[model samples]
Target: MRFRRLRAIALKELLQIWRDPRSLMIALLMPFTQMFLLGYGVTLDLKHIPVCTFDREASQNSQSLLKHFEASSYFAIARNVRTYPELISAIDRSDCKIAIVVPPDFSERLNDTGTSSVQAILDATDDNTANIAYGYAVAIVSGYSNDVALDALGRQGGELQQIQPVAVQSRVWFNEDLDSRNFIIPGLVAVIMALVGAQLTSLTISREWERGTMELLVSTPVTPSEVMVGKLAPYLALGWIDASFCLIIATLWFGVPFRGTLFTLFATTTLFLTVVLGIGYLLSVLIRSQIGASQVALLLTMLPTTLLSGYVFPIDQMPTIIQDITYLVYSRYYVTIIKAIFLKGAGIAALAVPILFLLVYAAAVMTLAARAFRKRLD
Candidate 1:
């Protein structure tokens, strides 16, 4: 309640942070290191997938189909196989993820029955990659079939409209280019905020105990509320700084889109930081060992954020039980809010539900953390 005492305690803690080299390294270097590492290292986009082919006919039609795969940005033709064993060996050696086989009667079937099939073999070890590659192959083959159909129709002197199917007009919004980085950077920002805020603040009260200063702190006239606020204020500011750094790197360096207002970003981020900082401070007050507190804080913040928060995986695709459990992880709400704000240009009104959840979470955590800290050494 006393501003003077709170200011003095805050200054003392800030001075302690300045003096501790490990704290300085954590507070300064961790953000930069995490941003670059996760931003570039983690991704879902697959490009230039290796492909091997076996053309049974060695005919012009088969060669043309092979050219279609080569021209695609998603596939690179690595080998032209003479036999089925060669195709299998290429996949076994991991030289190619996909294999294409042009049938011997491919052109004859097309001409006689107006239909033909090309065999596609896939290495299904990584099923997700295999599925994506299969879809790409299907699209390329479908286009080639359509081209052949049109050419046959022209040769027969028939109008294109007679064989034409309905065309689909698709549109993409938010992340128009379908760049994963656009959404990923925002999720990274949320993770960094939770991680750095908790990890840094976890050491605050625990450090006081380890340095033999708990006695002095107990003897002071400062109320528990004042001590808690003073100890956490510096970290709250630091959370914002870390947030700013992440935003700058994401928008400028990595070129992630920023579609929302600054007010929406700051408001949600502050609520998120309060929740994480409270969790860390509570850990610090309960656990006297600085190392123990820090480790527990890291486990609490990082695991749920990365795993259950729909960061790298889709929550809908997870098991029903896991999807229900994700509701309890605080980072899930923040991740959803952040992605919406970054990609959809959402505002406070649009994000009322998640922001409300965050506000309640912050209040509950602060209540527990503020009451957890007492001047008594016991």
Candidate 2:
């Protein structure tokens, strides 16, 4: 609590961080590395899907149908085959994700019977990709079908009449372009902060034990509160630096829209960083070995934050039991809060619930970390 003692402890910790090459690399370079890697490397939007074409009739109608797939941005015609075995070979060689096949009677059926089916062969290895490809293919075919019907009507009788009982209009809010980066980058803030903060603070007291400086630390007149706060102060500043770096990269470099105010972003980041630092410090106090403390901190912070915080996967899609367990993961609240702030531009009033949970979590972990450390060598 005394400023002089606290300042001395903080200065010592900062000096240690400055002198250690590993700590400097982690604090200075790791944020940029992780942000670029996770931001650009991860995405959900699939485009330029490889497709193979097999036209049995080789008619103008079949050529026209193939043209539709070729024109679509989602489908790229990678191979054209005449025989079924060749089509199968192309698929087996992974030349394509979807195969477009026009039946021999496709044109005849459409001309005479006013109906024809185009077969879509999918590689179901990646079911999600396959499903999306199938949806795209269906949409293209539906549009083509409408075009064909209109042409036939115009030739047979007159102009086609358009009538609709209901028209559905959709307005996309927040992520207008449906860019995954907007949401993913915000969650990355939580992940990166948790990882960097915990990894750094977890080494502080444990480094003292490893270097035989515990006696010096114990003999100091500073209380446990002063030592803990002093040790965490430097890391808290590093955490802020990393957070600001991530926000800048997310908004400027990656073009992820940051709709939230600066105050909301930094305020929540501080609370989240406190929880991360406390967890690391608690582990460092409990486990005296530096390597052991660092590993334990990774296990406690990184894994849970990535897996349980809805970073890449949707929580509702998870098993009911797993979804329930996510409530205990503090990063989940921070992730949700940051995403809301970034995407929805949510204010403090709208974010009260998650912020309250995060505040309680920060207070609880700091309490445990403070109590876990003692002045004696037991």
RMSD to the true structure for each prediction, in A, is 1.4, 1.4
Query: How many collisions between residues are there in candidate 2?
Result: 0
- Find the 10 residues in a row with the least total lDDT in model 2: 159-168
lDDT of 1 by residue, 12-101 (tens): 988988898987787777778989999999877778999999999999999998999999999999999999998999999999999999
Q: CA shift at 22, candidate 1, in angstroms?
A: 1.7
lDDT of 2 by residue, 216-305 (tens): 879988899998999999999999899889888988999988888989999999999999999999999999888999999999999999
What's the residue-level lDDT of 308 in candidate 2? Answer: 95
Clashing residue pairs, backbone N/CA/C < 3 A, model 2: none
Q: What are the clashing pairs of model 1? A: none
Candidate 1: lDDT over CA atoms? 0.90
